[model samples]
Target chain A: MTVLEARDVSYQYSVGTPFQITALEHISFSVEKGELLAIIGHTGSGKSTLIQHFNALLKPTSGQILLYGKDINETKETARDARFKVGLCFQYPEYQLFESTVYKDIAFGPGNMGLSKEEIDARVRRAAAFVGLTEPMLEKSPFDLSGGEKRRVAIAGVMAMEPEVLIMDEPAAGLDPRGRRKILEMIENYRRQTGSTVIIVSHSMEDVASLAERILVLNHGKIARMGTVDEVFSHAEELQNMGLNIPQLTGIFTRLNQLGYGVNPLTYTVEQAKTEILRYLHKGGAADG
Target chain B: MENDSLIKFNDVSYRYESDTDTPLPLAIKNIDLDIRKGEFVAVLGHNGSGKSTLAKLANAILAPESGKIFVNGMDTSDESLEYEIRQTVGVVFQNPDNQIVATIVEEDVAFGPENLGIEPKEIRRRVDDALKSVGMYEYRFHEPHKLSGGQKQRVAIAGIMAMQTECIILDEPTAMLDPKGREEVMKAMQRLNKELGVTIVLITHYMDEAVKADRVIVMDSGRIVLDGTPRQVFAEEETIEKAGLELPDCAKLAHALKRSGVNMPSDILTPDEFVEAFQRCVSGGGVL
Candidate 1:
């Protein structure tokens, strides 16, 4: 089922006293239910602008977005409902945590949805658990929690709304490796439990290679490429031309291939590379041997 | 102290004013370190672990409550050396948007030199030189906000480079950037260190970035927990894990392989290294 679809979306940002910048132009893509998509791009590639359209945070200048087969901008009331259905966790979401306690912060979304007190409490607790925030930590002041904890709480706030589609923009930005792993694991677990469509916008190719099932490459405000991981990563030259990099493992494999090694081009992750190498070794080192 | 030691922290200990316990919550504790001239040192630590505080201390943005800090032989605690310290070691913060004061790129680059009261002609020369060093001279006429995050960050670095300070401390300079932005900033730092002989102190969470530095310092809970070369520091996966930090992807894969009884180098940091190691293992029939 198509959980979210963007048809020829375009966005423009007014600049200076007279000029306007076209951030995105005629971008088209559709995300299916329970699928994980990653958007990769350089700094000015309009990945942020495109993701903002997923939740109706920014209206498309020329196209339309449909959530669950219903046009998001069909009506003002529908757009507001779209916001609840598609939860957006922005980059550096910790800055948005303004509530006193973590529990109160997580509850804010459910409360805004006009859910009952019991439902709000239940949602808050469930969201907290989804993000790996312990019960004791929920009652503590969000300001007192560490940076990673604050981030989780901020994500929990959005998850409490029970959005059918969750969008995170650089969710692990500025986090240590362990913190990054923990948060990504939490996200994966959340997806498993809820089966919601997840979109992660990140610059790290390794993260995208590891987590995302489908990859979308954005360049100069257009959909440069979109496909499965193997298909997208196989176009290493195109991605590099757009000032983006493939995963380091894929880069190494490409280099090896250039050096006359017959390594598989479909390998995107280190584990896949390892398995391929082991199989090749077990069958003798030569390609045809 | 050695003649070339640009910055020295001698048993420094600091606590925030808000904490009022018997032994206050130490922001940085028992830090005895020296940064030599032209050395590029990377500091790694989780958030709230006091690495940022240590960066601030190198420039005397925050004073050690109990110990002494010296910038180029001048004590930081002395009021007379305040200007000298500020002029000696420049700081670039994480948020480029917040640190940039001027609307235009060239004007932003000129702010540091202008504050130093350099001649107008000299200021222009230094601004041009700084922007050129970071490969941002072409965008000198551009507006700061119109630039990409990476470009703005490079402009911020140029602002410090224009100051012509002996040392530059960047606190998570790539935190707000994409991968390409990070590569650009890291390359700029390398150029400044190699070509200009400027001492570079970078505080960051990315292990891959830390690997490029000459030395690595890891902090946790306001103390220097680990300090060594990147290989030495990262080899201690236990300590890294205990500090709530993650290893680079290559390192993690290596560790995983080791756990599965594959004999690979634990110090593998890059994908190339991992690939080479795996190839060697295969040749030796090490893989099951």
Candidate 2:
């Protein structure tokens, strides 16, 4: 079932005077429930602008976004409803954490939903646990926490609302390797538990290859390509033309193929490449069939 | 000049000002390092691992509470040499949107030279040269905000380049950019280091970027936990895991293969290296 769909969505930014910059044009795609989609593109490719339209953060200039087969802009109430259903976590979400304590920050979302005080508290605790935040850390000031911790708290704040469609923009930006891995693990765990539609905007091919079941390649505000991870990565030349890359492992496999090694041409992850290489080695190191 | 190191940290120890306990929270502890002229060094650490603090010390943004830091043979503790040290080592921070100041690209590039009180003609020459070096000369007249993130970062690097500094320290310059922007910025940094012979101290979280540097330094909990060429540093799986860091995916795969009794080298930093090493192992009479 299509949980969210955009029909010919287009957006324009007015710089000044009468002139306007078209950020996105003729964008169309549908995301199903429990699908983990990654949007990859170069800067100014309109990936962020398009994702903002998913939750009605920006009204389309020429088209419509349908959440559950209903146009979001049909009514203010509907748009507001869409906002809760689609929890949009902006880049550097830690900057949006304004509450004094982490608990208050996480509770802020559920509290705004007009839930019972007890229910809000329960939801906040559950959200914190989902993101791996400990009990002692909840009462402490958010500003006092480290960068990665603060990011998790902000993400929990959104998770407290229990949105159906979770959208994250570069959630691992500026994080170290361990922090990046921890956040990725938490996100996967949350997705498995909640089965929400997950759309992540990122630049790292490795991250996208690992987490995204479907890859959406956005170029100049248009739906350049959308397919499975293997299918998208197979168009390495096209992606490179759009100023993007296949995963580094893919590049290495391509190089090995060029050097007369009969390796599988469609490897996206290190494990796949390892398996293919080992298979070739086990076949008496044959160069070709 | 051959005997003199460009930058040296002698048992340097730093603690944040907020901590009051006897054993303060050390940002960097007992760091002893020597950086020669025109060396390209990449610093890797997870967040809060003291890599940024170490970069700041090179330009005197932060002083070591214990030990000494010498920049171009001048002690950073000497207040008199602060200006000289800062001018000798320029810093480019993470966010290009935040670091940029001027409306136009060329003017922003010229800001540093102007601050150094260079002559107007010299400033213009430096700015033009710097912009050209980073492949931003064509965008000199364009509004900086109108440019792409990668272009803006290149402009930021050009600003530092115009200062005519011997060393440039970039603290996660590509963290805020997309993969293409990252590629552009890394290429520009490599070009600056290769062509101009500028020493580069790049602090980054991306293992792929670190693989290209001549040397890699890993910091953890305010300590220089690992330092060597990328191959050497990435070879120590236990050290990397203990530091709360992940090896490059290729390195991880190599480690796994080694555990499975494959005779592959454990220090593979890139997919290309892994592919080459595996191919060689198969062809060089290795047991399957």
In the order shown, the candidates' Cα RMSDs to the true structure are 2.5, 2.3
- The residue-by-residue lDDT of candidate 2 on A1-289, one tens digit each, is 9999999988888756353678898988999999999999987799878888988889999999999999999999999999899999988899889998999999988887879998999999999999999999999999989999999999999999999999999999899877887899999999999898899998888889899999999998888999999899988899988989988777877777777778877677667866876777678665442
Best by TM-score: 2
**Residue A27 CA displacement from its true place in model 1, Å:** 0.8
List candidate 2 segments past 4 Å from native.
A15-19, A258-262, A285-289, B1-3, B19-23, B128-151, B285-288
* Residue A98 displacement (Å), model 2: 2.0
- What candidate 1 gets wrong by more than 4 Å, as runs, is A15-17, A260-262, A286-289, B19-24, B146-148, B252-266, B272-288
Compared with the true structure, what per-residue lDDT tens digits does model 2 show for residues B43-131? 98888999888988889988889999999889998888999999999999877888899999999999998999999999999999888
Candidate 2 DockQ, CA atoms: 0.59
Q: List the residue pairs that clash in candidate 1.
A: A178-B246
User: How would you class the docking of model 1?
Assistant: medium
DockQ of 1: 0.55
Error of 2 at A127 (Å): 0.9
> Cα lDDT of model 2 overall?
0.87
- Fnat (0 to 1) per candidate: 0.59, 0.68
Model 1 lDDT per residue over A22-132, tens place? 999999889999999999998889988898998888999999999988889989899999999999999889988998899999999889998899999999999988988
